[model samples]
Target: MLNSKLLHKKLFLDSGLKTQVKEVNTSNLEWTKNFGDIAPFMQLDLRLIWRNKRTKSSVWMLALGLLYGLFFYPNPTYNNMPFFFIFIGIFSTGIFLINFGQFVPAWDSGYYKLLMSQNIKYEQYLKSKFTLMALSVVILFVLGIPYVYFGWKILLAHFAAAIYNIGINTHVILWGGSFNRKKIDLSQKAAFNYQGTGAVQWLIGIPLLVLPMIIFALFNWLLSFEIACLVLTVMGVVGIVFHQKLMRFITGKYLESKYKMIDAFNQDN
Candidate 1:
C-alpha cells in the first residue's frame, strides 16, 4: 500500500494530477505517499531563491564590498596588511548581514511555513539554510575577497565571519521573525514603522554591517589584536552550538503565535 501510494505521488508529480490518476489506476507502486515526497519541495526552495530579487541583492552588495576593499585594503607595498585585515574583515560583516537579511521574510512567508507544517524535521531545514548560506558566503567572498586580503587572512577571516553570521544574526532574524509576531505585509506601510519594507531592509542591513565592527573595534581598543580576534572566534563557535535553541524559539514562540493573526489578514484576500 505504501509503494502504491508513493508511486501515485511520483506519477502525479512527473505528469499531472489528471494524468497521474489515470496511471495510478493501473500501477501498484505508490511513490508519492511517503515523507520522501518532500524532497522535491526542498530542492524547489533553493531553485526558487533566485527568483527572489531581494535575496540576490547579496551579489551586488558583494560587488560593492570588493570595490570598498579595493580602496580600503592596507597598502601591500608599505607592508600594512594587518591593519587592512582588521578593517576589511570588519567590513565583510556588513556584506554577510545584508545577505542574511535578504532572506528573513522569504523564510518567514515561504519556506519556514512549508517546512514547519510538514513532517520534515527542523534539523533538515537548518541544514538547507546552512547549505544555502554557505554557498552564498562562498560566492560572495570569491567575488569580493581576493582583491582585499591575501593568502591566509582571507581564508581565516572568511571562516571567522561565517561562524558569527550563521550563529548570531541569522539566528536573530529567525528568532525575531517568530518572536516579532508580525506577518509584515510589504504592501502595508504601517506594519514596518511607516517607512516601508525597503526601510526595514536598510535598518536590518545597517546593524548587520556595523555590529561586529563595534564589537571588534571596542575590543580591539581595550585589548590587543590577538585577543579581539579570539573573542570573535568564540562567537563563531556559539553560532554553531546554539543554533537549534534559536530556531526553536522562533518557530514555537513567535511564529506559532502569529498564526491566527496572519490567518485573519490573509483570509480577507
Candidate 2:
C-alpha cells in the first residue's frame, strides 16, 4: 500500500511539471511583437497624448466650438456655412493633433538616450508616427461633416483640404517632437506648471488648427472651391513626403551627435 501511494505521488508530480512547462511555452511573453512594427510609436504616442489636461488639447478646441456655436454661428445659412464648416474642420483636426503631441516626448537631448536604448528601425518608427497621424486625420474628417451643413459635394473638398492640413501638421510636429526632454505626467497640483509645453509651444500649435481656416478663406476669396482643394491636395502630398525625407535626414544627424548629450543628462540626473 505504501509503494502504491509513492507511485501515485510520482505520477502526479510528473503531470504537474509537464503542465507548467507547457504554460511557460505558451505564455504571452513568448510572443514576440507586442504591437507590430508601429506598436512602439503608437503605444508611446497614445500614452503621452492623454497623460495630462493640456494633453487634452481638444479642450481648447471644444471651447472654441462652443463659443462659436453660442455666439458667432448660432444657426447655419449659406453665407455663414463656409466659415462654420471650416471652423469645424480646423478645431476638430486641432483636437487630434493637440492630443497627438501629448504622446510625444520632446525631441531634446534627453529623449535621444531613450530612443537609442533600443534597436528600433527608423522606417518602422516613421511609419508608426505616420499611421497615428492618419488616424487622427480620419477622425477629424469624419466628425467635421456633422458640424458642416453641406452636401457631399462640399464635404469632399473640405475632406481633402482637411487631410492636407493634417499632413502639414504631422510634418511640423515631427520636427518639434524629435527633441522631447520633459517627463510626462497626468497628475500633480499646480497642474499647468507640471505640463511640459509653455505658452510659446501652445502658440505654435495654433497654426495647425488655423490652416483649415486659411484654406477656406483663400478658397472663398478665389470663388473656386474645386481649384482650391486641388491646390491644397497637391501641397499636402508634396509636403508630407518632403517631411519624411527631412525627418530621416534630421534624425540621422541627431543620432550621430546625441550620445554626448544623453550622457551629460544621465550623469546630471
Candidate 3:
C-alpha cells in the first residue's frame, strides 16, 4: 500500500512538471512569433517610405534640419543664444515626427481594413511606428553631428532634444495618432500634401514642441542658459526613464480607439 501511494505521488509531480515545461515552451514560441511579426512590419514600413514620394521627403526635411546649424554657426551672438538651440531642437527632432506621425494609421488607409483582419496586435502596430520614428531621431542626430563645430553646447542641446523627442514626443505623436481619421495619398508630392491634416495634428505641436520651448525660454530668461538646458535635459531623462509606462498608456489609448480608427480610415476622404 505504501508503494502504491509513492507511485501515485511521483506520477502527479511528473505530470505537473510536464505541464510547466509545455507552458514555458508555448510562451516562448508566441514571443518569437510576435517578434517575427514586428520585423516584417518594420521592414514593410521602410520600403513603403522609400518608394513613396511624400514619405521619402522626410529624408530631405531631416537634411534641412541639419543645415540649420549653418544659419546660426557663423554669428557669435546667434550661436550663443539659448533660444537658438530650442528652435534647432524642435526642427531637428521633429522633422520626421511631424511629417510622418501626423498621418498615423491613415497612411495605411488604402489597406487598413485588410491589415485589421490580420492577426496583428495593436501594440505591435504602435510599437513599429514608435520604433521607426525613434530610429529616425537617432539618424538625424548622427547627421547633425557636424553642428558640433559651432560649439559642444550645440551638440549638447541636440542630444537633449533627441532624448526628449524619443522619450516624450514619440509617445505623444502615437497618442495623437488615435485621433487621426483623414486619409493621406502617399503618392502625392510632399510639397503641399495636406491630405491628412487635422486639428489634432496641429494641436499636438503645442505640447510636443511649444511646451518644452516655453519651459526653456522662461528658465533661460529668468535664470541662466545653462540652467535652462539642464532643465530640458532633466525633463527628457525623466521621460526616457518612464518610457515603458508611457508606451503602455499609449497602447491602451490605441486599443480604445482601434475601431474608430478603422472606421475613419475606411472613409473615401
Best by TM-score: 3
* Of candidates 3 and 1, the better by lDDT: 3
Give the better candidate number (2 or 3) by TM-score.
3
What lDDT is obtained when candidate 2 is compared to the true structure? 0.56
Q: lDDT per residue, candidate 3, 67-157, as tens digits?
A: 7677767788785577778768767866887677877877788788788889678777887888788878888888888778777877887
**Model 3 bad stretches (over 4 Å):** 1-37
lDDT of 2 by residue, 1-269 (tens): 99999987777777889999997765423222454766756666555444445445543454443334334344446444564555554445555555555335432223656776786675566556666666666765665565455355356555665667566766666555545444444443223454455443665565665665577668767876666666667777787768667667746644654554455445422
lDDT of each: 0.51, 0.56, 0.79
Residue 74 error for model 1, in Å? 5.8
For model 2 the local lDDT of residue 89 reads 49
TM-score between model 2 and native: 0.61
Task: Say which prediction, candidate 2 or candidate 3, comes out ahead on lDDT.
Answer: 3
Q: Is candidate 1 or candidate 3 better by TM-score?
A: 3
- Which structure among the candidates has the greatest lDDT? 3
C-alpha RMSD for every candidate: 10.9, 8.3, 13.5
